[model samples]
Target: MTESRTLYGYFRSSAAYRVRIALNHKGLDYTQAPVSLVKGEQQAPDYLALNPQGLVPALSDNGVLLTQSLAICEYLDEAYPDTPRLLPAEPVARARVRAIAQAIACEIHPLNNLRVLNYLKQELGVDEEARNGWYRHWVELGFAALERTLANSAGPYCFGETVTLADVCLVPQLFNARRFSVDLTPYPRLVAVGEVLERLPAFAAAHPSRQPDAPPA
Candidate 1:
């Protein structure tokens, strides 16, 4: 039997969103322990003990704590292999999926994270215009490359047909782009893929707006 699991995360955290998608995709039942990043709840001592980095989307399963969104998603995939697999079966295809996922998770996200943006404004004294410029710069660069990658694939999803790690990564990043008002009209394939993926129950239920911690509407 699978051990009881809990996830500590913020509603708007893209990293946390990735885990939520994975959990739903795997058909696993878990509880959410909301950590408010905007209000600085992630830095509280109690939360700090769970994740020294003070990041949202930390997972606890059977008393084992796991941080880092991608690692946590992979752990879920490994621990529960029977349900819909997050990674592809073929070696090359799996690598391709991982590559696309990492491109967003590792490259684009780090530069635009809350802490990084705070640094730009608080430390570097950047104006709001410049800060927004920084955000758009990385997102456009990443999406341009991803658009080319997806153009070659058959998709209502990122890879062939099934939702894989790439789709999980893409949807959240696209959400972030829209949150910041990034013009997505240029990346037709990525936008199209996201439109379809967002309609799926797994993706729909994992949306930030639907999370329990989401702000009062």
Candidate 2:
């Protein structure tokens, strides 16, 4: 039997969204403990004990704490090998998928994180328009390179037929981009891939609006 899985995450956090997708893709049963990022609940002393980084999506599996969404996804794959694998079997193929995942997770997400954007507005005195402009600039810059990369290999998903780690990461980044009103028409390949994957049962179940902590629409 699988150990009990409990995920602490915010409903709208992209990082947390990644974890939820991974878990659903693997058909894992997990409980959610919502951490309200907008309300500053992630920084509570109790939450800090689980994750010193003060980030959403800290997971506890059978009492073992894990942080960082990408790493946590890999761990789930390792721990549940019988389930659908997120990483491709070939080394080169795996590397290609990971590179795409990191392109958004590291390069795009860091600059546009809630904390970073809040700092820009609150500390640096940036106006709403300027802050949103900063968001679209980085998203467009990152997606240009990402579009070129995916155009080479994308079919129905980021890595062609298989739903790899890259697709999991891609969906959430697109979610944020749309939230910030970034133009997605420039990247048709990504939009098509997202449409295919988003319709899948796993991805559909993980949408932020479906989460327990999501605000009423």
Instruction: List, residue by residue over 51-113, the lDDT tens digit for candidate 1.
Output: 999898899987899999999988888988898998988999999999999999999999999
The list of candidate 2 runs beyond 4 A from truth reads: none
Those runs of model 1 whose alpha carbons end farther than 4 Å from true positions after fitting are: none
Per-model TM-score, in order, reads 0.97, 0.98
How many clashes (backbone N, Cα, C below 3 Å) per candidate? 0, 0
Residue 202's lDDT within candidate 2 is: 93
Model 1 worst lDDT run, 10 consecutive residues:
149-158
Considering only N, C-alpha and C atoms within 3 Å, which residue pairs clash in candidate 2? none
